[model samples]
Target: MNSSRHYVIDFDSTFTQVEALDVLGEISLENQPDKDERLQELKSLTDRGMGGELALRESLSLRLDLLKANKNHLAPLIDVLKGKISTSFVRNEAFFEENSDHIYIVSNGFKEFIVPIVKELGIKEENVFANTFVFDDEGKIIGFDKENVLSSNNGKVEQLKALDLKGDVYVIGDGYTDYEIKAAGLANKFYAFTENIERDKVTEKADHITPSLDEFLYVHKMNKAISYPKNRIKVLLLENVHPDALQIMKNEGYNVSLQTGAMDEDELAEQIKDVSVLGIRSKTQLTKKVLDNANRLIAVGAFCIGTNQIDLEECLKKGIAVFNAPYSNTRSVVELAIGEIILLMRNLPDKIAKMHEGNWDKSASHSYEVRGKKLGIVGYGNIGAQLSVMAESIGFDVYYYDLVEKLALGNATKCNSLKELLQTVDIVSLHVDGRKENKNLIGEKQFKEMKDGVIFLNLSRGHVVDIEALKNNINSGKVNGAGIDVFPSEPKTNKENFESSLKGLPNVILTPHIGGSTEEAQENIGNFVPGKIIEYINTGSTTNSVNFPNLQLPILENAHRLIHIHHNKPGIIAHINRVLAANDINIVGQHLKTNETIGYVITDIDKAYNIEVVKELKEIKDTIKFRILY
Candidate 1:
């Protein structure tokens, strides 16, 4: 390993968990009703495995055109981004105090979003290298620096070569650009971080595959600069995750294993015998029994959005943190929704079917324009909220219904009840959560309340609506056309055959739950989700944590520290301090926080503590688990 000590990290899918550009586009074009088609196309290209640089170029151009996105649009986008910062970002003030000089963010993504995030991480503006955006006199976003080397293909390697840093250059990221640093021989070591997207090419080329930055520091003996092989993480790639994910884990020096095809609970348990990190998609059913057998499983990777496949409660009981791709596929799902809305209004599905059967039937009277239509949205979370603004921009009078309060955007109106929204809107879309109570939420009664010939879309969850009821509603002419993406009982693997109840209906659109299946979204997903997982495992940071104690801190240097996980009770901190005081260890710095059930404390001490302090700290009545970081 080259001993020169500087590190470079990617932004999109590498630092932030989602593509900020895509999120900005969705938020900015809330008033444009005509750019939906282009948005869909952009999302598709990204999901199909387009490189981040290319995906950003196409998507950014399309969004900027639709948005005329200027400075005014940027403030709201910044708010959205600030609220959605990465979970692994070093937020500890002390950690930043120690390591700020060595960390750098090198990205092809826009400087607008990157600057704020880096500033939050305590990295100075001078430490960040990114593409700059240009706005016209009208304040409309025009273009980026085409001449900037970082924006070009292989730009990361070129940028690093120009840096001429003293120490070994260590690159961490989830894209081909980051991998190119290693491939080009500019960096001494490249870490393939799968916490975001796992590219086969990048993983195959990486020197190490790290799930998180914490893992990287731990492996290098850097955090506290101590070496211990027992702390080495062993990862198991179960069914459903891409092969690239496994390769990256192996490259990272993890004792990695892979199990192909589906397995029953017993087989799954047997396979995870020694696994510490379990990676899976929707296929693998991580039941309580399976989890009970996994003595060493510390984490679960639900590679997809919906976590219904995994037993979250069971995992939590075992202290296993779970991570999923929530916003990674937002653009893909929104694009598909927009396409379906246009298709359904135009009666394109039926027209295409007739044409394919060699029937030349031309009827414009039955087709209507998407513009000037009423669009009703249910469960205004990430996907629903995004679709709302996009639909409104396309001239659709947007009405949304959510159980919880949501901030209104553009011309979108909020209906207090689902019934009220259904009766008033021409198109009804489901984007609710995957809660059990949501099953059959939009069955016959809700459909009956909808205006006759109303368009319907279900891009959320299969269980959110009754498929049989939806099919019946279409037959009775209560609904004009429908787009159904997700299903209640989808086949786990790509190889498995899928059967659906809403198979053959006139003017009905059936997609393979591909609302988020665009190449852009998938690559973002592959690049983003794994990065979050990796960051969490590496840094003990959990800004986007679905479970476990949430601790945010600045990056820590080579100071010996004790991380204590305990029951969130009163006096836990005092007791921890007492133990340290009794051991006579000097406390250089300390930070403490608590979630629902657990309290986490990171105490930086002078690098000469006896092992007895750790032993005594673990014996505290409230302490759940403890580890030393040195």
Candidate 2:
């Protein structure tokens, strides 16, 4: 085993999820007349160059010429690439950070975008051997650095030879340029990295083949565990979360079990006893008892906006992270709210019902357009603010009231109190959260304060509005029409009998809580939330965790990582270090962060210690949990 082995890795489709040139071409020629033709040409050129069928320099030149990009496009493209890194590489970023000195990004991709992306992973600029772009005075990319070795055929091989000295050189990439390193006798081994995409021609030439970076490290006995497997992790998705989420989890090689409806808490506890990852929407509750029975559960993903059904504090105490799609479904809810407002204001529900029953009576006596109507919005968050803009565009004066001071969008007005908003607006829509304080935010008094013939809507929490008060107002003709989406005591399954006080009313529209049930919204939630859960389980990242201390730790190389979660108290890190020091363990790197109630410390040390070190770490004061990952 060589401690100083040089790791020369490819960039496009190896380090990133997409080919940089293809992405740049898309961004550059977007909406242009020649976009389709130019994009296809660039993609074909990229494939040829990557598959070793064309000279690297000639292929790169033609692609660069096809890109009608400017300097301004690089920053945004870099941002996108930063997010599109191969999932395996992203989860194992700590390893690159710890071994920055021996890591080389030998790419035919340009340095302008690669520099910013790899720099975030701690890879230094000098270690990045790639071609530079020659730009015009107007910042438009005109040509490439023709003199650079990376521009020529077998450029990675030439660069590896130029470096001249090392213990050993290992090449890991998806393309043939990387395979050339081994053919030139400069690399000790060539491992095909096909986690993002596979090229059979390149794969056939490799000494070793792996789907993920973690697998390569596993083969070398350097990884703590193969978190990035080809597809063996078990996931249980309930409550009819979008099939796209299931497909994503399966695409990453996970075995999945999916169901369409919420389950009883007792049944969930029994079912999730051995589940590794559990996903649910709003109804299925992950109670403390349920979590206690989940022996192998490492992560929970909520496919909806609110995670109130999940016992987050219990999950956090048990070392489980909770993730949700808070932003993905916001627009769906807003669109539904706007549509329902229009239907309610014009008295369409009753008129449609009469026509359905074969009535010819038609009148405009109780009907009205949305223009000049006042819409009072409660809880000015994502959905509320969006609905405000659309309502205003349709000529409705929008007034919003939130406990927190929110910036008004368009000509929407901010009211001093919910009471003031109810007094002025002809329509009231609820969009509050599931916090305990908001249980009955809109009850009898609030309903009594609204103007006569006012329309009412509740697409927020089930109990946010008093259903009894709303039904009574509709009966009294004080509320002309109402659209109710959620109920405080709704049935668990769609087939179960539903009983609501607002039902059987002429102008009341009762929907089955499909406010955010659009295909686009569910698909977005399915993809976004599962990725976060996978990232947390793989990298110990708490960046977007709902109930854990957030910490972004660097990757560990040839070292053991100790992730210590404890009470937020002083001297925890010092105590942790002392215990390691007493056991003759040398610390390589450490990161510690603390919130009001919890402290998270990540310590990386040389792997020459005894098991007693872990025992001693468990004895540290205020230590809530301790585990070693190497």
Candidate 3:
């Protein structure tokens, strides 16, 4: 708190998020037939006045005449303005309360509206310099006080000179008149406040363009609630993950942008150059080249279930945490598996095709019920386990096999090996993951081991099963009917055509990969994945991170939290503590977790410290990434 430094802030579009006169016009002209036209005029006049195109006196006169607002409108207008305070200002309320003596509300607006709003923030009423609204005998608006210097052109500069604010005056505002104070040599610096609005003419003349009040406080090393503002963290969400995800990130105050579809490797690499957080579905690939170009990336969120499209090993080496929705869409994929099994078992694809061609083949030639069928589920993961229980309830004897041992659910039985499950079941549904070892796990040899005329389904990864072998098996009648939702090759967008060997086969149900594509499943995923990423970012909690060690961090309070990700080697944690000890940084609490390749350590220390400590910590050997969470 530097007592010599004075802060002069504007009211409309700077302290509050809206123009005052425009709101007043809406309130007073509510019953008027020409309310829309009057509101438009009020907005236009405000822009011209703020742009320095119109005199302040003339602007105020015309706006008041247009408003025709009585004393009653001022009270309601104050309530609305209170709620409309700039988000950044609301976050730093403590700073304003502590520095009330040095902070002033200097605007060309009215004191009746400005004082009430600033009063709640601990601003002194005498420090507020603005015009006074004169009223008639009936309490209707008539005019303003002409004697006040704020009602004239260049009023802010004239008013500041009269007050003679001492030492290093800083002006934060969105209008050209606010910039006039600095231009007239009354203020030291002019910051163009753009949290609510950005005027080109005003920002072009500013010494600094502050996106939020937090940015200004951060630069000045003031005692603020946040060490780093969320508005500085750039989040790029691609493939149109979900609207809920977008809203969630925005509510967290991040600079979030959304792209409708996934980008190719080259396009993604360029777009990720400066992005701090990247969100995508399965279509976007996070290759080595793309990750290498991401100079500022901190986390990658796989909004879908599988992380096969991302290079997990590379992400680990780069100290980037990766997350995915492992169980959010499980029920959706399981329900789709059951529906597809019934459709393929009844040979409905061929029958439905014939019906479309006007051939009324009302014959149950090969249609069979699935009540007593054996349903074999490969890879007993979330989707697999859920499918097992659901299939058992549908009167099918469920059998499952996985590389790792898993407990059987309900009356379902676990197979000892893949060969054993293939030989026994009538319907084989692949619910495996996207590991490289699982690619082409089912080829011609495995298909041959399955019972003849068996039904097959692959709703998992595209490359898990050899498509050519499955196509030959279906054609030879060894597989009576099949449902293949995934393939080795697919189109990136819906506008492109898809071609596969399984297509045009008799009794084969070839669907585009849409196993988990339900409105409910998408919404569930939208609610879960972004929330996890937000948790990891806000509290350094990596409980469900795929590529990082799991640590369920508690919320940080009354201290600064520092996170360091480095190569997993001996003496890394010891060296970090040594550096902190040398800088006199008292560690309040500390947590360390490590994997085979990377070590993550979070340290909480006293809030008071030098910024130079960060540079020393980064200079340590084997350091990958470092960040401060305050």
TM-score against native, each model: 0.63, 0.65, 0.89
lDDT of 3 by residue, 1-630 (tens): 898999999999999999988988989999999999989999999999999999889999999998989999999999898999888898788889989999999988999999999887889998898889899999999999999999999888888988898789999999999999999999999999988888999999999988899899988989777778788899999887889999998888789999987799999899999899999998888999999999999998998899999999999999999999999889989998999889988889998999999988887888989999999999999999999889988899999999898999999999999999999999999999999998899999999999999999999998999888888899899999888878777777787799887779999888878888888888988889889888989899998899999999999877889999999999999999999999888999999999999999999998576768999999889999998877
Error of 1 at 569 (Å): 3.2
For TM-score, the strongest prediction is: 3
RMSD of each: 16.5, 10.1, 3.3
Instruction: Kindly report which residue pairs in candidate 2 clash with one another.
Output: 94-554, 94-555, 95-555, 224-630, 231-253
Candidate 1's residue-wise lDDT over 113-190, tens digit each? Answer: 788876876887888889888888887788888787776667777788788777777888877778777778777888
Better of 2 and 3 by lDDT: 3
Count backbone overlaps in model 3.
Answer: 0
lDDT of all the models against the reference? 0.74, 0.85, 0.91
TM-score, cand. 3 vs. native: 0.89
Q: Model 2, range 11-83, lDDT digits (tens) per residue? A: 8898898999899988888889989999999989988988989998789878888997899999879989989
Clashes of each: 46, 5, 0
Error of 3 at 164 (Å): 4.6
